[model samples]
Target: MKAVQVSGYGGLEKLELVETPVPKPEKGEVLVKVKACAINNTEIWMREGAYGTGSNSGWRPEGIKFPRIPGSDITGEIVQCGSEEDRLLIGKDVVLFPFTSSGERGNEHIAEDMSFIGSEYDGGYAEYVVWPADLCFDMPLKTYSDSAAFSVSGLTAWHMARQVDIQPGETVMVTGANGGVGSLNIQIASKVFGAKVIAITGDLKNEEQLKALGAAEVLSYKSTRLQEEILECNGGPVDTVLDVVGDALLAVSLKVLKKGGKFCTSGSAGGQITQLDLRILYLKHITMYGSVLGTRAEFKELLQEVSNGKIQPVIDKFFPLEKAREAQDYFKQHGKTGKVILLPKTGDDLQI
Candidate 1:
């Protein structure tokens, strides 16, 4: 099997493609022949040592082990099962759930024993991967690439919307609206949850496309009067702010929110740290939430929505397994509007 392993937390040099022995499924697990995997900021941040204390970063406190395969949003076909009872899953097209947790139903994402795919276990940046049979759900979209685009980003965006409890007709501001998670947030909040979305992106050229995806209005983050513009578009402060570009828009997010408005954040692409005045937090009675990947139940609902054609996949580019480094670099570049996919070239001519 051909796999790309991250030797350590560093730059693109950390990701190396190597030929390794294929892994077999353990009890209750199944082996999947990798078809497609999507690139995300999680893997990029993990490699950059940005998710934890200085010089050591990962999904766990022990830090990531060296030479780990990195990819989570995966779509593939099950080829073998460890347990005889699970053999029915063989030949099934599936999308991985992205993580495992010990917490009870609603609180799974914050469980103490939570382990992420590609972080705690070998992931789909290879020709084959082994995951628990129970964690593999039927692919929502017809093609591997389309189904692979959502596992992580869509889950995170769905959880953010649920955290803020977006209500019908409420105006919600989504920052970094052109990115994968941001774009999905716009769709789920507006199309599914019935909220009016005010999309904030780096480019106005994406305005029409974003509106087609359900955004009520699109504004540029580069605007000097961003706060005023948001207020003007909504006719007042927005009911909620879904922000992924941390420090760059934190102040503006706070200022443009109506009193008692909710705010939810899942990423920090622009900057991480920012200064916030306590007065604004307390005086306005604002509520804030920090979100990440969601639970099994939420994942199921998101999949159903996609399967029902309520939410569409936004794919930006594709690269073969050998181009992992270049793919990661392109994923981080500015102006890209959606998920970047990696094909394992496993002889399955999967199409989007």
Candidate 2:
């Protein structure tokens, strides 16, 4: 099998495309022939040791194992099942759940033993991958590339919306509104949750597209009067703020929120650390939540919504597996809307 392996935490040099032996499924697992895998900031940050330093930089406290395959948002077809009872799954198209956890029901994402697919186990950046049979769900969209776009970013966005408890007709502000998670946040908060979304992005060119995705208004982050613009456009302070750009918009997010409003954050793409005055939290009575991936229940709901045509996949570009380094670089560039995909099969063999 051909795969891309991260030898260690570093730059693009860490990702190497190489030929390796195909892995067989263990008990309760199944082998999937890779179709499409989307690129995300999580895997890129993991490779750069952004979460921490030394042996604690990955999804787990033990850090990433050397030469690990790196992709989580995956869509593939089942080629083999580990047990006779699961043999019926073979030949079915599926999308991976992206994580494994022992936490009970609603508390799965916060469990002490939660393990991510690309980080804790070998992932779909290869021709074949083995995952627990129960974790694989039927693809929500007909195309592999469309189904692959959501597993990680969409799940994170869904969890954030749930954390903030967005309500119908409420004004919700979504920062970094052009990226994968940010774009999905706009759709889920507005289309699915029935909220009015104020989409904020660095580039104003995406304003039309963002509004098409259910945003009530689109504003550029470069505006000097951003806080005022948000308040005026919504007719007052927003009811909630869903942020992915951290330090860059933290102060403005708190300022434009209605008193006692909620703030939910899932990413820190712009900047990680920022100075905060305690008055912003106490004086305004703001409630904040730090969210990550969601539970099985949320994943199921997300899939259903996509299947129902309520949520749409936004794809920016596609690359062959061998050009992972270039793909990761393109993914990080500003102003690209939606997911960047990698296909293991080359030369028009796959319908990306």
Candidate 3:
């Protein structure tokens, strides 16, 4: 099997494409012939040794094992399975959640004893990946692999935008407006929920693209006047602010919210620790929440949205399994706007 692996925690250069042994499913597991795998900021953070701190890892679990194959979001065909019921999924195309939990430790989900495909175990950055049946979901439709590959980012966006309990006619602002999650969020909020969407793009180049996705307004944050521009465009009050790019943007985004508005964030490419003032929250009566990959049920609802064509994945590019490093580099350099995909050695005509 040809796969991507890293010698240790470092940069993109650490990724190695090599012929590793193909893995077979265990008693309760299944093997997937990966059609497409997608990258997330979580992989980047985990790879740079930025995940899991002092007994608390953000997504990588408490004792994250490394020298890892880094990719989580996946879309593929089932080649084999452990049980009769599980094997029923074989030959079927599917999309997966990648994260699994067998139990709960109070309010948060404690990862069960199972592996988190690309993070803890060898993921789909290879010709084949092995995992249990509990982690997989049959893809509902025929679509581009990159589109199906957006499971993680798309579902995360749905969870974030839906958190405000967006009511039609309400207004919401989305940062990283053309980004994987942000783009889907824009369409989901506007097209499905009928919310007025205000989107923030780092580049002025994406303004029209944002608007086409139903953003009521698109502001490029470069002019140093984005914070005010957003408030002005809404003409008065904005209901929710979704921040995908953290750092300065978080605090700035909060400032643009209407009284009693909600703030939601999922990624922090702008640097992990951003400052936020607590007093302002009290004065304006604001609500804030951190978002991550959705729960199983939430992902189901999102998939329904996908099936209904209420939202669609925006893929910036795809890569062959061997070009994993280039894919990672392209994403880090902002050379790609949406999800980057990795396909297996199965010799499919599918291009990233």
lDDT, each prediction: 0.92, 0.93, 0.76
Distance from true location, Cα of 224 in model 2, Å = 1.3
**lDDT measured at residue 273 in model 3 versus the true structure, 0 to 100:** 83
Number of backbone-clashing residue pairs for each candidate, in the order shown: 0, 0, 1
TM-score attained by model 1: 0.97
State the weakest 10-residue window (summed lDDT) of model 1. 343-352
- For every model shown, what is its TM-score relative to the native structure? 0.97, 0.97, 0.91
Per-residue lDDT of 186-260 in model 2, one digit per residue for the tens? Answer: 999989999999999989988899999999899999999999999898888999999999999999999999899
Q: Identify the candidate with maximal lDDT.
A: 2
Candidate 2 runs further than 4 Å off: 346-352
Candidate 1 residue spans exceeding 4 A from truth: 347-352
For residues 1-352, what per-residue lDDT tens digits would candidate 3 score against the true structure?
A: 6788865667788788887776878777888787788877777776777765543443545645656777788878878887777767778777877676664532123345544656777777877778777767868568537446457788788778667799999998988887778888898899988999988887767777778878988887776787778778888768898888888587777787888989988887776786778888999899988887666777778888788777766777877888888888777765245677776668554221
Cα lDDT tens digits, model 1, 276-332, are 897998899999999999989999999999999999999989999999999999998
Candidate 3 stretches greater than 4 Å from native: 52-61, 104-115, 347-352
Query: Per-residue error at 341 for model 1, in Å?
Result: 0.5
Greater-lDDT candidate between 1 and 2: 2
